[model samples]
Structures are given as structure tokens and as C-alpha cells.
Target: MAVSRHLLFAILLPMAAVAADFPPPLLIAHATVIDASGAAPLGDADVLLRDGRIVSVGKALVAPPDTQRIEARGRYLIPGLWDMHVHLLRKGRPEAYFPLLIANGVVGFRDMGGDLGFDEIARLRREIADGSRLGPRFIAPGPLLDGPYPTLPSITRVLRNADDAAQAVLDLQRAGADFLKVYNRLPRDAYFALAATARAHHITFAGHVPLAVSAREASQAGQKSIEHLFNVLFACSSQEDALMREKARALDSTDVDERRQLRAHYLQAVLDSYDPARAQALFALFACNATWQTPTLVQRRAYAFPEQAAPDAALLRYVPHDQRWRFDPGQDARLQGRDAARQTLERRYFDMDRGQIALMRKAGVRFLAGSDAPDGEAVPGFSLHDELAELVAAGLTPMEALQSATRNAGDYFGLGDTGVIAPGARADLVLLDADPRADIRNTRRIDAVILDGRLLQRAALQALLDQAAEAAAGP
Candidate 1:
């Protein structure tokens, strides 16, 4: 992807003259580079960037007289993070969320689903590619394909049958969507059709497991990734039919005790039927087929405590006031309004989130970290770090958790040169003041971020956040 000259002019006009004269290469000296490709961090190393690409990386490199140097000192430098799932649309100006992603140290994202039009999103992708926008690299699925009448406002297209499913994939491909998203309501035939068509066209199919399709069947049928852990829980169960039948009967009944019994039965069944060998086989299919999992733990956590007052301070700070209100407007009241029976049914779903994560990891599932942010209690940017922290709580090592956001995502998306710090790689790196390996929370101690050779200090990143907040507040 070549950066356009016009884009350069539009973005760098103020600093153009100062940047024109080939000043010595920007050198990041004496930093520990955690080059995310499973390599040992190099101590006392310097990375030199020129023309937005890494030119050299090693120790004992002499800095040229004209070289502008960043004294990394004792900081840890790693590849800029990637959020595999995000909704790039905001409340007022839908396009405002992109820059905010960059501001929070995300250099790239995969928009799992959003409300933006395909043409507009394509333009934004191009603009970011051309350097016309100060945003992270984007990959989008355009819109969702739902069935039995699309319930979500974000879904612009719906599949009525197998033909509709095939045509929907074609339309999404034509609209420049990078993948096809399957929703929960899709019919079995339509689900298979969508997956087959996507495979034939070399488009990745991802999202929820329809009620008619088991996770095992979907994996074998070429569904690229599963968004939530619910699908896996379904597959891991040895008695899915019995469980589903119980749930259906519970739904049909108004008796509180009956519903409670059914809910308890389902949870107990899940714990009893969780077979490690079966999980390993299922995850092997995922790994063999190059499938990915975007476990949006933040949303899972938020929904876990439905009766809670609101989101925590860190997440609340990033969301616009109106959007925050929209997400939690008397959520406690709503929870209270639900009969105890119905509340328990919903709560059962929440309790399985951590267990699902643990089971997936135990089976060697390839996890991709995502917040599902700015929707419900999950805020963007900052919420991603919370996801990392949650993954650690779920038994993933800090390095393993970080890999889910970096190298793992890049590999899944076929981005060859962006996830690791190496010669010839793009200069998207984060310099942290503390050792994140020691404590995952240390990732918050960001000193600076380098995006395609452009150094943004902490103040500049904060300014970007303020700009996003302002735009989100607009009429």
C-alpha cells in the first residue's frame, strides 16, 4: 500500500518543510524490542526507521549526525497492538472512532460489524492507506447478513433463503467487504450456503453459530471464525440436544421454579460434559483451518453483573456522555423488571464466559482479543486493554495475551509485515515505560507510539482522544 502524495500534503502540510529535508533516520536507541514473532527480546538494541519502514534493528549501530534519536532508555518497545474486532462507527459522526483507535495505541483493527455504508468505509480505508487520515489500518466486513428478518439496525442486508445467502456473499464482496458475517438467526441451509459461497470466493466467513448449526458443523463447513464463546460451549457439550430441549421447554413455561431447574441443569450439564479431548479436537479443527476466535470479554464481563450501577471509570471516560447513558440507561431497573426466572436464564449465559475461555485455552484454541467496544459497557481503545487484563485473569500468560492482539491477529488476517519488529517491517511500535512482561497492567504506562514512522507523544495521543470525544458529542 503506497501512501498517496496528496494525502501526505493534506496531513503533513504544517510539518512538510521541516520533514522534507531527509533528516537522519529516526533512531530508537537502547530499548528492549519484543519482536512479537516468538523471538527473545533483544536487550540494548536500536531500531532505525526511514521512509516509514524499519531499516535496521540491532545493537552497535552508529547514529548518523543528522539522525533524530528517541532515547528509549529503560522502556520496552513492542509491535503496535491490533484489535481484531471493533465497530468503527460512533454516535454523531460515524467516522470519528478511527483516529481514537490510533490514539490508544491500536495501529490496526478488523471491524467485525458496523452501521457505515460500504462505499464510505471503503473510502475511509483508502484514506487511511493513503495517509489522508490519522487512523489505524482497517479491515471491515461491510455489513451483517441476518435471517428471519434482521433485528439489528446495523444489518442492511438479510438472507431469506439459500439463494439469498449466496447472493449476499457476492454482494458483500462486490461492496468491498473483507469478509462475510453470519448472524445467529440464519437458517441451516442459508448458513451452509453463505459459508460455501464465501469459501469459493476466497472470502472469510465469521460470526455467530446459528441455532441450526453446531460449532463442529460450522467449522467443517468453512466458517472462518467464531465471535463469541457461546458457540464453543454448544459444541463441547455431549448432550446438546437434551440441553436445547430443556431450554426450549423452559422458555415455553412461566413457572419460576421450572425455569430455575432448567437453568441449573444447563450449567451443570456444561460443566459435566466438558471433555478436554473433544475440545482439543474442535480446536485442532480451528487451528488446522486457520480459524480465529474474537472473545469480546469486556461485554461478557459487563453483562455478567446486569444489576451493577454502570461501567467502571476508565471505560466511562472514553465514551461520550450521551452514548454512555444510552448503554446503561436504568440497566439496573431493566434487570429488576425481569422476573427472577428470566434473570437467572440470562445470568447463566454470563457465568460461562470465563469457563469458555479457560476451556478454549486448554484445547490450544487460537484466541484473538477484542472488546466489542462502544456498545453496551465496552468502550473502545481502553477497553481493549481491559480485555487483555481479563485474558490474563482467564489463565493466559501476559505474553500470550499480548500475542492475541498482535502477532496472532496479523497472521490470521494475512498481514505479512506489520505485527513484529523486524527489518523491513512497518514502524508501528509502542514504547512502554514499564515492563509489561512482569505485569499486564504495565501496558498502560505508554511513553509514546510510532505509527508508520510518525512519533506521537503522550500529549498528542491525548489530543486525539479529545478530538474524538468532541466529534462524538456533535449534532
Candidate 2:
């Protein structure tokens, strides 16, 4: 449970060279401030920033005579967003995605497991700290801790026993991981051991609820956050225990084809046996335990209805050539060779997932906005906006959707001064050309971004986008 020196450095150095990179004391005059604190927007507000922190926020903020000022009249300002779940170094060059994230107003992120080594992650952190890179501040578990037979063995630490589980947790904690990234296919006993070790060390472990463990058990075991809503649907089944047993067998199987068939059958059984009463009870339990959910609905939707994964020309301009194939359903094996009945089942599962999300929200289960970007049709940064829209479509109010990425994210990560715009808060603000409160889609109408007090106005933001596109286009 001991935090590594590197982890401590990452936490302590919020902005190591901000004074040199940013302007003098800066002020934004006459803008609508949507602080994302579940409070009403303050109109005609002025916010002053100095040395990477908000100096003041009010109707009239006094600043030094030489202070740099932005005439933000008619614009809306809110805390910069956080993509609670991301895979920055998963597929493409991680640096190439940084400008895209910043251009879309994502100032911070939690990188889900990727292929990068801890040393590489540390290097990226150093570059960002020294203002040598344009990117989001991030916390990551360099790679996932998966079962002995992992889905992505190349980017995983395979655990075989209780001893392995315990050691994995401690090793990741000491390797500067913000939290342990658990995965599917883990043995039940090993999962419990991992969870116990995490709790003993006062470290957090979160990710997929292992197939051998039920979601209820995962919630009770203190898994901090559930990603991709994995196993949640099955837990809402009236025959949950029966389905879980089948899942356990699937996990233990040596045959890949058998495992795939078993998983498909188990998922169908879950869909068939879903009970509203059971779903409600499970959601209540999650609420009670404060188990956070990061559904990554955009990615789910893409997988569910892959036939509709037509390439988006506008968004595609920013996607790297090698990665653009992910936007085409015809190229995906899962999307191809699906019969009519299979398509119907996929649609049904997706609808139920959205319905369950709505129910969970009403039951007071807190959510974190995440787009499993570059995984599905989800494009980094832009997909986060799609996620907010999807959240709203699933019955969240626009403000609530916005909060999932902002206030809720800050609370989830325990980043005190983040995700809010107030005196003493981090100077990571997004200026929107339209008010997001009126429509969550307005979050995409970003006019400017202020990262660690260094303002990127419209032109600078565009430059970031242009750079990203050029990178995507390759040399």
C-alpha cells in the first residue's frame, strides 16, 4: 500500500513550470460561469487566474495593471473536462492524441490499462510537467492485471494464484500506478485476495468485474469503480447465480471457441432473465456502497450496432489512417457474419443497458463519463462529447451529464480543486461558444481552453486540431 516516490512526485507536481509557460495574471471578463457544482450559472462573471490557480471568480475581479485579459462576453465558461476512462497509449502514438484531447477541452484523464511500460508513462508525465507537451494531466495503471489466460496478454500482468494477486497489487502500487486495473477471467479466490490486499494497503482497485465474481460480490468487496458496465447486466438477472456459474465455467475453459460460445449464451441468458425488481435492488446496493460506474456507452453502442458504424468524414479527418479501419463495421469480424436474430439480440441488449443506466442514475448510483475511445468508433476527445449526449439520451439532465465528466469526476478521484470553477480551483477552464446547460451538445462548441493558466484561444485550439490532423495524415 506504500505510494511510490514517482507517484508522490506525480501528485505533488501539479504545474512544475507554469509561471514560465503561461502569461502574467490573467482575467476573463463578462462570461457565463457554469461551474458544474450543481449550482446555477453565474452570468456576467469575471474570473482571474494566476500561477495555475484561480485567483478569484466574481462579477468584477481586480487584477494587476499588466494582467492579460480575455473579453469572454457572450461565452460560457466551465471547468475543463475529464475523460474518466481512456487508453492513451493503447493503439497509436500517445503524443499524437494529446493535442486532440486538449483541443476538445479535456484537461485531465484517467488512462485505463495500456501497453506502455511504467518508465514510458513516467517520461510522458515529465514532458507534460515541463510544458514540453500539450496534453491532459493523467493517472494510469501502465498495464492491466488480468487472469492467467488474458484477452490481451501483450498488455497484461497475468495472475495465477492468491500469491500472484497480492504481489500484483503491491507491485503496481509501488510502480506508480494510480490504482490497480483488474480484468476479466480472474479466478474468484485470486480476485478476493487482490481486493483484500488493495484494502489492506489503502490503495484502490477498479475495472471489469471478473467473470468468476458477481457484480454484487464486487460491490461488496469494495472495487472502487466498474468499467464498461461489465457483469452489471448479468447481476440484474433473476437467474443471476445460474448465469454466473456458467460465466465461471467459461472463464476456466481452455478452449477459446467454447469460452466464446459460453459467454454468448450467458449474455443471452442474462438478457432473457432480466428482472426490474432485481435490477432495482442491485442498483440500490451500488448506491449504498458508493460503487462508481463508468459505462462508456459510446463504445458499447458502436459494438451493439456496428452496421451503423459508417465512417464519419468530419470526425475521420482527425483519425490516423491506420486506425480509421475501426470506424468501418464491414472490417470488423464481430459486425460481419451476424444473422437477423443475432442483430435483434444485440439491439435488445443495448436498449436494456441504457434502461439500466437510467434506473441506476435514479437510484442514486454515481456515474463517471468515459468514452473507451479508439476502441470502438469512439474518437478521443470528440467521443467524450458523444458520451455526454448518450448520457442525456439515457435520461440524465444536461447538467447531470456535464457533472459526470466534471464535478463527479473530481469527487471520484478526490482531486479537491478540480472539476469546479471557483477561487483556489485549478485554472483548467473551457470556454464554450454556446451554453451547455441549454443543450449538452454545446459542450462541443468550445471557443477556448485554459490549461494550467496557459490560455489556448480559438486560434491556438485550432492549431492543436490542425497538428493532430497532420499527425493523423502522417509525414
Candidate 3:
């Protein structure tokens, strides 16, 4: 079961070998292109793709004699969307999620946390890159590092102290992890040590801001990104209250009311201390500091509303019947006597967290759209579109929300040639039925998804989704 580096390369070698043959160019014509670069959408444009790269894009582009042409009339083309945060191995088979993501126009994803073997993930990345697999590009950490009893069970290692944290980073770097993911339970010293070690190893540090460390400290310490919107909530809190809260004991179900009161007090203090001058200074620091945030509002909304705990129909199709009962823990925990109170606390946390996201956006903090999809209430590819919709609800314009998934993510991850439709950019683009520039919801009307110039039509996309659902339902 251990996927080794050699095995991974073996799995990918066929794709690279196939790509060695020069294929005929693919020409897509008569499409409306939304390049995600804030450029005006081009009407009746033609995109020329050759050997898995976009060679030209313009109106009335002439195709070579041997080029295979795809007529895309009535479709709107844009760069493929990126789910900036996801956990590929949460549902047991990380590979199953790839086609589902591609089906819904998710051409790239950052694995915020997962238990996937690095070799397997790297293999999948290579296979997709070389056109062996029908999937999106993947960026992932090897495993999660946390103190004892981390919330997510997929965490492969635990850090007990600063030394453990430092060693964990080096181990992950050796394992070829794309980044170091820190969890919420680590102590202040361990968190700082991990950050320092990640920097020394030149590995990107990302994940939850530990309760013991202030968000500002984590940002200043070179943590590349923060997940779950918790860091922003901590950042918006009054510095004095944040310091006090950091020393408080871990929260428990019995102390739910007390936690809410403390959180409210901290939030009010933050709002009261909201000096525009101070906020501007803080925003400047974040802008230059390379810190990113994934709001993951789709998951937030799902956790917030227990009254509506039923799964979305599209999502339910992919979740196994045996696992369906896992969706509503409160209902399952009716015999435990703690369900009601826990549900109430969850709802409260959701509302406050969303409010914190609004505040962070207003303060000019950088954000990456992530669904945390196919995890609990999130529904993989569909959840990302919902993230964009929720972001629009939080006051970002359609373009801004789209940017969060496109150019913003590409720029943040140093993928300069992607997230745009230019002369030399990669051909990872989606063709929608409607103009998403006019409305964010139009993003869902996907007509086709173009990955490295190979187009997957809507019917093909549906087939991929069906295949994933079948795989998830299998014995």
C-alpha cells in the first residue's frame, strides 16, 4: 500500500511517453473568452492549442491544415477554477475525487490537509500533467502535524514539543511534501519552531493557526497560508483579549456558553478597536507578508445550520449510504444528551466565523476560495462554486470572487503562466454557458472544461461524475 517514488514514476511514465509523440494541434473557435486577468471578454475568439500548450488566441485565428478544430460557439471560455483548499484522502480514495473535481471545472486544488502518500499524490500530479489521467493538478502536504488528539483523524504524526515540531517539518520535507500543515493543537513554541523549520527547509507552511499563537505572530513568522477562517477571526480580535484567550484551557462541551461569551467579548473589543489607521497598517503587512486565507464558507454554512442538516442531492449521490448517517452527528448523538447543546454551539461558531470573514475582507486581507470539499458537508467540486457564491454574498463582486479562484490563486502559488488565457499561458480553461462576469452564479453553467487543450464536454463531465459516484458506492 505504500506508494514509492519509483512506483509513482512508473505509473506516470506511459503518459510522458505518449506525450513524446507530437499530436496535431487543437483549435477551439467562436468562443467568448473570460481570461480571468481582468481583461475584457473577447467575442467570437479562437484559441489555438498545440502539444498541450496554448499557442495563440485571437479573433479569426487561422488553424493549421492538420489542426483538429473544436467548434465552441455559444460557450464562454475562462481559466479553470482552483479550489485553494481541499483534503484529497478524507473519503479514503484520493484518486476518486480528481474526476469529480474536473467534472465541475476545478482544474487545480491545494490539498490543505490529507493522509495521501506523497508518492501517490506526486504520481497523480504527473499523470494529470502528462494527460494520462482525467484530473486536476494537485498541490499537497505529506501529512498534518499536530499536538495530541488533533481534530482530523487523517493526521499521520503528532508533535509534542518544539523539537518534535522541528523534526516533523524536516521529515515532511524529506518525504517531498509540497508544504507543512500545522494543526490547531500545537503549543506556541512548537508552532514557532515548525514555522522556522519550514522556512529553513524552503517548504511552504500552511494550516490552522494554533489557539496558542496569535494570527499576527503566525503571519509574521512566515506561515504561507491559514485555513478555516479561524486565523482571521483571531486576527480581528483585540490584541489584549487574544493574548488572554491564548492562555485559556482547551474548550469543552460543558463550557460552551462560557466560550461563546468570551468570543463575543473578544469580537466586540475588536470592532471597538477598529482604527482605520491601524487596519491599513495591518493590511499592508499581510499584503507583503505572503500569508493567504481560505474562507471555505460552503462548509461554514453547512455547519452553521443544523435545522437544514440534510445533504444537497448532488452531494448525497456520491456519499455512500452507510456514510449518510455520518452527516448529522446531532441526530446520531440523540442518545448522548449533549447533541442539542453541541449543535447550538456549532451554529453560534458558524455565524461568528462568517462575520469575521467579512471583517477580514473589508480590512484588505488576501483570500483564497476553498470548499474543503467532499469532507463532511462539503460536496467536492460543487462546494467550490458555492464558496464563490457565498463570497459574493459577503460583498465581493462577481469578478472579485472569480479572481479568488483564478488569477489570485495562481499568483499566490507562483503559477504565473496559468489562471489566464494569454499567448503563452497553459490551456487549463473552462467554457461556461453564461457570462460569469455579469453574475457569479453563471460559473456553474459550465459548457466545457479544457485541460491542456483537451476538451471535456458537459456529457463527458457528467460521465466522470457518474464514475466517481459509482466508485464511492462500491463495495
TM-scores for the candidates: 0.86, 0.95, 0.86
C-alpha root-mean-square deviation, candidate 1: 5.0
Taking every candidate in turn, the Cα RMSD to the unseen true structure, in Å, is 5.0, 2.2, 4.7
How would the candidate models be sorted by lDDT, starting from the highest? Answer: 2, 1, 3
* Cα shift from native, residue 38, model 3 (Å): 1.3
CA shift of 120, model 2, Å: 0.9
**Candidate 3 lDDT tens digits, 1-475:** 1233432343234335456654688888999987877767888999998866789989899888999887889889888899988877554555466777888898878787765677666666666555657676666776777777666656557788999999887777777776678877777888889888877766677888777777778789988777876655445544644534632442432475555555445545554554445445555666668577787887767655645645667677776565566566455432233356555665565676676555566667778899887654676788888899988887777888898999887777665666888887777789888888788999999888877667788889989988889876876
CA lDDT, every prediction? 0.72, 0.86, 0.72
Q: Put down candidate 1 lDDT per residue, 426-454, tens digits, no spaces.
A: 77889999887889887778889888788
lDDT of 2 by residue, 66-91 (tens): 89999999999999999998888764
Candidate 2 global CA lDDT score: 0.86
Candidate 2 lands at a TM-score of 0.95
| Candidate 3: stretches off by over 4 Å | 1-18, 21-23, 126-132, 239-248, 252-281, 329-352, 355-359
